[model samples]
Target: MLLDTHMHTHFSGDSNADPAAMARSAIEKNLAGICITDHLDYDYPDEPDLFTIDFPQYEKGIRQLQADFSDSLNINFGIELGLQPHLAKKHHEILQEMDFDFVIGSSHVVHGLDPYYPAYYEGRSEHAAYLEYFESILENIAAFHEFDVYGHIDYVVRYGPEKNKNYSYDKYKDVIDEILRQLIAHGKGIELNMAGFKYGLGHPNPTEEILHRYRELGGEIITIGADGHAPDQIAWDFDKVPQLLKAAGFDYFTVFTKRKPEFLPV
Candidate 1:
């Protein structure tokens, strides 16, 4: 009974998926649960207000779905915060308002600009741009450690101009190792975002090399997510997850309830 631990719905500014539809899709696929980690990237570059959400209303909606699916599917309340070094305090205020089941702290915008946009890679070589992105994760975690896991440690690769064609974990291991160590020290975990495959990267975010290294470094709390924005995408490429984690030396994966972790066999 694996849970698709990250997804989004209409509550997410970038998505218009029906919450009920998402849950139903999970149940139909025989998943034990799915966590709704909708977008909440405060102070996004151009779209200043697009990624924000109404917390109370958002909680109410997820709670309703949780009750509705209690008999068959498990749904958890979660949010994916776009990590920026400066917005830590603002994000902390929101997390205090609710007891979310999970939180994915991800670096969508590095240096006040999103890597999704071409401009972010325009001024520098892709390698330099990517290196700066990994370095910025340390700054973000230094400012805030409330998140349960860091989502898509290598998300920048997905939108890179060459899209992982020349990317390798060893190419950036020094900073990446520190990033993994920092998360372990702070008691935070990393997510295996399967959305990397959906984005045509032919690999998961953080890739196999990073996953293998995280395990070698004794980081145990790894969560799996599709980073899906809709029903059709939930648990995308999840069939590859169990074997992937196993090869990374993991025999278990993780789930969260009321901010507490519950380990389940993989």
Candidate 2:
């Protein structure tokens, strides 16, 4: 089975999952490894609570989970960063100070507001909003190069009002191609976040089409993640992963440890 590279726990502002419980859940699913990628979004707008996280406590939690489940499955300490161009230095500093096995740079908010909220879509067409979101990704990549993989390149579609009904990779390839090229040039990778299926999009985030394009463009590193926030959600829809990659022209997927990647057969 593919290792789940993205997940969250109580340490993250948006989840209440216990680290031990999440570890046990992965063992039950027979997953060989999992990276407990808790949220770390510095300067998130409008949410005073902050997803920056209690680093000391969060590190302590994952360490304990690792000790308890050491023999059962590989539990890696990782983080999911909310990308904002201005916070690049802060993100780099934290990663340098920590011993994270992996880091997923993601854009949960764009231009000071989360697309999950209706206010972000208030006066703009969904198409325009989506374009702006992709553009923001370029700005972020330009500022930060410390992360190992880009999480859900098309995350905006998951919350769009139309919800990808009229979306296609070709529709935005003009910019999406550039995004893919930037990651390739930097030797970075993208993750196949299964939460898209849980969200009823009937496809993984970035979808199969983008995956194929990434491979076709000479990009090789790709990671698979459930983006699970709860025990039951761990590795959700994973059975489709192997074939999904096969259809996208990938014979292998990638996993990270100590900030490095190891390819696994699909």
Candidate 2: segments with Cα more than 4 A from true spot: none
- TM-score result, candidate 1: 0.98
What RMSD, rounded to one decimal, does every model reach?
0.8, 0.8
TM-score list, all predictions = 0.98, 0.98
Q: Where in model 1 is the C-alpha error above 4 Å?
A: none
Task: List clashing residue pairs in candidate 1.
Answer: none
lDDT (CA) for every model shown? 0.91, 0.91
After TM-score superposition, the amount by which residue 229's alpha carbon in candidate 2 deviates from its true location, in angstroms, is: 0.5
Candidate 1 RMSD computed on C-alpha atoms after optimal superposition onto the true structure? 0.8
